[model samples]
Target: MRDKLTTIGFDADDTLWHNERFFQLTQAYFAELLADHADHDHLMERLLAAEKRNIQHYGYGIKGFTLSMIETAIEVTEDRVPARVIRQLVEAGQEMLAHPIELLPHAREAIEAVAETHKVLLITKGDLIDQERKLAQSGLGELFDGVEIVSEKTAATYAEIFDQYGDGPDASMMIGNSMRSDVVAPIEAGCWGVHVPHGLVWEVEQAEVPTSNPRFRELKDLGDLSALIDQIS
Candidate 1:
């Protein structure tokens, strides 16, 4: 088993560092900005709708989210959204882009421990520049054998990445907070999936847990990841 598992894939955002909370905070402010036009619930719903509609055109990350906020505001205000509000939205995204990286509990330790014996790769999806900025700021960049800033997480994506980095998807494991991308898709591609819950999650990333699958695992935090790998090996 030790020799069989040669590669480990880690998700960047919420799994290894503080990410979704910043988005949540910005969203709260977004709700406040358009408080006059719509209630909190309705505004969030509309913003989510805008995000869903805009994802294909804009892709994921702060810029896409900011644009969606602007679009939602325009819709709710019947195209009367103030220019000041749009300016603020853009500024909010700018702050998120420049924000310092904060590592999640045990993130670095887990990476260091795992990387000693297994190849470690960072697999994430977002705006290329913003993703690169965060990776640079994270200070963990030097540890990874490789980095893959993908456009999306799918079975084929995982298969290709694992094959490029190590033996193949069947000989690799993916650890992340999203059940859809981190667990289901990787497992579908014949890799092991480890889910480390981050509490705060984006709606689009949500998916049902694959409890029936033998390769699926749920960790309380990254603190125990090394022990789990040891057990598996």
Candidate 2:
């Protein structure tokens, strides 16, 4: 273990719990509904492209993604599109809105393990109400020493968080799923980062390749996290 360690920041959403799986299912449903008008793969491509183009307008979350699907379906099929598909989209949207919250496997165990020797902080971004609700449902709300719900995770955000919690970069580490927002941001801010990759990562959260660095490491899953943290320290 390191002689002087202070804090570790963790990402929420896919990192701490199951996320994006619902969006994948919703996309599958959307494809089925649009099968008569266009190929499933083509429809998905168009929808994804539209979402990317309108990211600044719609932001992230199920509501925006569903809206993009609906808008794209209308565009591809024209106004003659069947009511059944539209209705299905509406119902699917509602189901996604109501989807239950759940924790990722080994999330709490990882948090508890790290918290034993470091100040564990949660660094997540989303609609404040929605994020807070998820955290409440996670059943490990009390585990974090600090909680930051930002609009975006950037180098500046990581720097601010580290500055507020610890003296310098060496005293802190970031453990999360997204290399772009979680790992890269903190690393650029001068803190070390450990990536715990989830099976499903959102496209928007992807990062460019890293050449190599001793302060950055990737783990297969949360199960390998504690051991890596020990090794790093």
Candidate 3:
């Protein structure tokens, strides 16, 4: 299987480096910032709703998330959210954009090992600027043969990407944390999907594990990827 694969796509955010954890931390701060306006639980509900609603409009990443936070605050406070709170929200987003890139354990090692014999690509959907910034800071940019910052991850999108890269679905593999984007979509596109569990996943990215799919694989971490490929090969 490994020998048959000519290209491997890796999801950038939580798969290669820390991402959702920062969002989780920022959410905690947001909850505290609006504690006086609404209860934590209610505020969280509103935030989730806002994100889902704004996803199509703003797409994914920090800018959209920051906008959703502001929208949620306004709604939760009945349009009475303070200017200070808004400023704080903007600052939180800026901080996230400037956050250091911390690669997950064995991420570089795994990528390097795989790249030695495969064409590795970074496939991530997010605000273009922020994603590029993280990739630059991650210091692993050179490891990938190509980088794609897409608007969304879907079966059609995966198929298009594979075609553009000159690799058929049967010769492509996608590895990531999101079952919806990384596993199901790619598998649906006829590519192999490998799920590497991450501790913190955004609610919108969540989906049930596809254990029934023959092309779907769940690994404990990126560290196991090489072995899995070898075994399958």
Best candidate, lDDT: 1
Q: Model 2, residue 7: displacement in angstroms?
A: 1.3
Candidate 1 RMSD to the real structure: 1.2
TM-score (all chains, Cα) for each model: 0.98, 0.89, 0.97
lDDT of 1 by residue, 141-209 (tens): 999999999989999999999988899987899999999989999999999999999999899999999
Predicted model with the maximum TM-score: 1
Alpha carbon lDDT at 130, candidate 1: 94
lDDT of 3 by residue, 46-73 (tens): 9999999999999999999999999999
lDDT of 2 by residue, 30-114 (tens): 8888888999878878898988876677666666777788889898998777777788888897787676788888889999999
The alpha-carbon RMSD values of the candidates against the true structure, listed in the order shown, are 1.2, 2.4, 1.5
Please report the TM-score between candidate 3 and the true structure.
0.97
Candidate 3: list runs displaced more than 4 Å.
Answer: 1-3
Misplaced by over 4 Å in model 1 are 1-3
For residue 104, model 1's alpha carbon misses the true position, in angstroms, by: 0.6
Candidate 2 clashes between residue pairs 3 or more apart in a chain or in different chains: 17-104
